[model samples]
Target: MIHSVANTDWQLASTAPLLRRGLCSLAQPLVSQTQRASRFVFAEPTIQLIVSGQLDLSTVHHHITMPASDALLFIQPHTCADIGNFRSIFLSISHSVVETLPRGFANTQTTQSISKSDSPFSTLALDADLSSALQYVISAIEDSQMSEARLRLRLQDLLMALAEKGNTFHNGNPETTTAKLRAMISEEPSKHWTAQSAGKALAMSPATLRRRLAEENTRFEHLLVDIRMHHAMMLFQTTNWHLSRIAEACGYRSTVRFNERFQERFGAVV
Candidate 1:
């Protein structure tokens, strides 16, 4: 079954108070074989520390695999799927906090270069020192006596460690043509997107775009439909919009068609 972040059922812990204060919280969701592939969208910058197992996070423009000794910081409004059975800790930082961070905090030299594109996600290896510090933070989260102020201090320390390491923010290389195309379609799911229009936007010929996507085991139409369906599910859960409005926003002129597709994807009605 496909699970989205909007579905609160997947959340195993409660962090409402921490989230309301614009502070970070820790989540340890149990990932089983039955629900191995789960989707999530981070509205703010998030730092994920893998405590055990392997986790694969894939976005429209990037694919990141975090083993037991890796961590990541994601700073965009990108939708990703969490593939694999892994118990992990997530530290979600508010956008305001990220914006106020110093320029060098991201450790740019180790980051993968994406020409003319700005993506805020980076991968880093978990060295011994960093791992110890992360362990402390995790412990603090479980401590009943750990006040909000104290927790914030620990978070600051973690951030400092990430910045000082210098190699934790590396992205590796520019996004592939297929990844860029996927991102474009996801960003504007409401638009009447076609391979030709996407090609124009990416400054590539339609044939070239199609070929690149084929190499990635995906097609332009498939990507468009997937993006639209995902958006529709999000809206259905988060908003009280009518079915017709949802269908229109998903680039469908007919609500009937939208409902049919939605049922096909989720085995339910809107």
Candidate 2:
């Protein structure tokens, strides 16, 4: 079941299998006017169903709008902003889901047939079939008695419907160490993460971690800051917490330093 918070915090119920794998449900009753705009970075392919209000997301060269009841597919991660008031369900499809598809379903031929635009985002029209399928998946997630095996079947059905509607989550790119670090750090940004500590957690030596991250063209320090900044951005969007509290939650003892880092990452004052 979805729990509504009084202070506008997006409290997630992690009882569902998908919740453990990145599926997020949010229902914000009141979003402060000052909090309407903030930067966002989607680390995985996500499909957002706007339950109420509207959302406007813009990149450097593109701007798209989604009104209530519309669905949006973020095919890849990019810098963007949120506008308008909205309660939405954001589902980040994990890589493993693609492997569960029918053997030939996620292949190159399937992706090639979906669409021509290789754009990073697309708006999906919720036709009768797709809408019904989405509802099924949502209901299954909300049902506390839902079995993991049954829920997986429901999710697979929903994905199949999405594919028929020209939105497929066939990601071929291998998950990099950079992505792994971001996911790990994002879970607990307030932790005093050092290269040595992170390396130990990741089953590698500090030198090995440095070498892997260097190969990915990123450093451990950079990943930590990026995760912290992104975590702060999400808090700004989903909660009514004061800036000082948000800063402290993101691992900064000093609000001024957190503000500076947020500005540097998003190129905007939050």
Candidate 3:
């Protein structure tokens, strides 16, 4: 099913759906709001693409929302929405495969999730190439019904996307403690991530990175949260996986805790 709404003066958003390998699914919908989305529960993981406009996901969970150029990957854990505008292409994936995502690569993002202050994640933004990937995923869903093999190949390509941070943010090898910190979040989006754990990976103490980011006007906790959100978004956008795996892959000791904290932060749930 394709759902979209827009005016003759503007390009309306739209989407489609497909089942692949009996293991995954693809869905796209261009929601222009005009109305509030009903509260519903999904039993599969999902990849959401924001083709244009904005989405106000005010009730799924903790402040969870994405706008133009932003996308979200949602695992099938029961979810309920208060209200939202469908301004993007939303894909519903499978929780089983989503759980297969290696912990080494969970939280991936093209644009950073910035906070109220001049934080780094806040500065990140989506570009054309990344947008192309979203389009490809949508197209695959539209035609995926024709062949399982084709859909599998396309899905592989989509998975690679999670590891890339985009040329726009490319700055050569991230070899220092900061880069190592990034790897922990992007490479192992989950696994009980903490300031101390991150420090240990970089062969330093938690106190060290905390001090380092502090010198640069940041904190270990803040950076850690950014990494979590980043990968969470990637998980929501790429694979049709489960919420349990998404939480653990991203380092939550408990899936329930993961959902609670995630909703608390993003203001939505999946």
Candidate 4:
């Protein structure tokens, strides 16, 4: 089953079933929006299917692109990428999914194959087995009657198939407090977030939270605005909501203020 995003309903197509080992979502940019130098933190391994558009990404060491129908794989966790893209299908591999692989599942030669790559991510065409596996996952998503156990099995099959091609996701490093903060706020950007409130949510004192964020060279206020601005971009690209409504949804009551922040963050206007 594929999640659908339309121009006007405002659902934003965020309800793709997040299975234990995997999750799938469609990225259809209804508007012609191109973001520049946007930082993306990947908590887990992710693969993108360039269904009908291209994607350009820059990391610390590499810059790569995938044309239409090309597939890109990111095996490293706690990594970041700056992307420029439009239409694509993204599937994420859970850390535990790779951690649970049977012993001897990945041989030395196959492991070297990934290590030989200069970049954490690789680009390739979809093989027959992988294509079939993706289709099975989609079918399972559409079938609401599909059992959770069955879906997990299907996801395992898909990942195993990828492993056979020498592309395997590994367990990610522990997430930093900054990363954790971003994830928490992204879940509901419209919420009224303050240092004290966010600190409570993360089980830290407000002062401790501020200290941790400063150690990471960031501030609590910065992360909140960053998360909200990114959410605004998603809504702008995926939905047909007006600026005022989008601003409200992102915890802003004044459209002018929201526009000012967005312009400062992305250097663009909606």
Candidate 5:
């Protein structure tokens, strides 16, 4: 039966699963704007769904802009990055979480029009129930007692709920104009890359690119920002490089611009 829940934070109940194969895990609201700028890097891949506000991301050749009602995914770890200005609440899971994904939901979708390869890993966003499930898990965590076993069980429930939601999200909307836009963003995410470059590469005229992206509920600059933010985060979490060096590696011509962009995108990095 579904457990009635309230907003709360709890110490996990179990360590058995964690001990068997400990997975790095940390889930919290993006703490501060500067942590947003910090080089505090993650040791593995992570994904976040913004419940509110805007987020900026930078990557190899592009920048990504992430808005509310949308999700941001990071598949691999990179060096040097920052989070832009935006107050957002999100959940983060480590690389190991991918192992728990159901089999049929795991393949890459290749039919994207603008982006020839790679797209939002999720073919469809989770349903309202899934969103509620996640919210419940966080709330449950807060209310859970300090028993280790109980904590593990709660976490398992959370993970299972998400997987179920993902399956539903995928089957419900196998096609969307937004899917094409997200796929394109996944492919290149360039800040300097304009709508023109995007259209030319996709074989659409400038006007058509604008129209198509709008129809999908997005803009070119936003996608570029999301791309950049994702890349920057990879660098921040995985590398031992200095902040300035990392920023340079991510494409900022100057450290100052990188810092500003990082906070502008992710908020103080924690």
Candidate 6:
């Protein structure tokens, strides 16, 4: 039998197999016009289903508009801004769960294919079959009486259904070189990042990095400023760190310069 437990922050439920792997499915109701933005660094990949309403997600390189009844793969860490109130179900897949799959499983193949793809993110429209399976998983997760073995079976079925939709998940090319570089820089915004230093970190020559970023309609200094400013905005919203501290954390030595740049980027005083 499936079981559900309610909590203050979210409606939480689990399957035995998934629980053993430290994965719990969650559903949350979003209020209309409630905007939330955060930086996410996922330790493992996740599959997110929009159960109701619509939301927009923005990364440094991609802006995705997810409508209701759609599914998207979040394979790496990025910043997400929810555009409006929307309800969502999140299936947090652990690394161990992937290891447990059979070598020849199509889900395994899909995972491998995605890892090899140029971009780590993709979205797919759920067909009738996949949609039905997702609804089942969502129901089973919310049902408190659902047994671990049964939930595991349901989860397996969902994976199989996804595999049947060949190339459904591998729907996009890899991110551009500049995007990758920007992700790296975002990971450590406090670092003293320069064209030469960033290029060295990405195993490219400084000149090549500059040229490629230019090809992507960005310059090194511009990209660096954008990254730093984004993080600064995040800090300002989420933390009470003083201006000097925030500036230092964003790799700015001069508070005056940091404030000037912040104002220019955000069109307001920091």
- The reply for model 2, stretches above 4 Å from the true place, is 1-19, 22-39, 69-71, 77-87, 106-109, 114-116, 140-151, 267-270
Ranking by lDDT: 4, 2, 6, 1, 3, 5
TM-score of 3: 0.40
Q: lDDT (CA) for every model shown?
A: 0.59, 0.65, 0.49, 0.68, 0.46, 0.60
Clashing pairs in 1: 110-170, 111-170, 111-171, 112-171, 112-172
Using TM-score, give the best candidate's number: 4
Question: 208 in model 1: Cα distance from truth in Å?
Answer: 43
| Candidate 5, run of 10 with poorest lDDT | 14-23
Residue 226 of model 6, lDDT score: 74
Best by lDDT: 4
Q: For candidate 4, lDDT tens digit of each residue in 1-270?
A: 343322122122343223332333333443355555466655567776665556777787888876665354544765677777655565655555556667777787887777675666876557666767876865775566878678767777887778787777654635678877876776678899999999999999999999999999999988899889867766776567889999998999999999999998877876
lDDT of 1 by residue, 11-74 (tens): 3233211222444545553443333334554534467655556777776667776675544544
Candidate 3 — number of clashing residue pairs?
Answer: 42
| Pairs clashing within candidate 2 | none
Listed in order, each prediction's TM-score against the native is 0.47, 0.75, 0.40, 0.76, 0.39, 0.48
Selected candidate, larger lDDT, 5 vs 6: 6
- Once fitted onto the true fold, the runs of candidate 1 whose alpha carbons sit more than 4 angstroms away are 1-20, 36-39, 70-79, 100-120, 167-270
lDDT tens string, model 6, 9-53? 223243111222333334343434454444433324456666556
Per-candidate alpha-carbon RMSD to the true structure: 11.1, 5.1, 13.0, 5.1, 14.3, 9.8
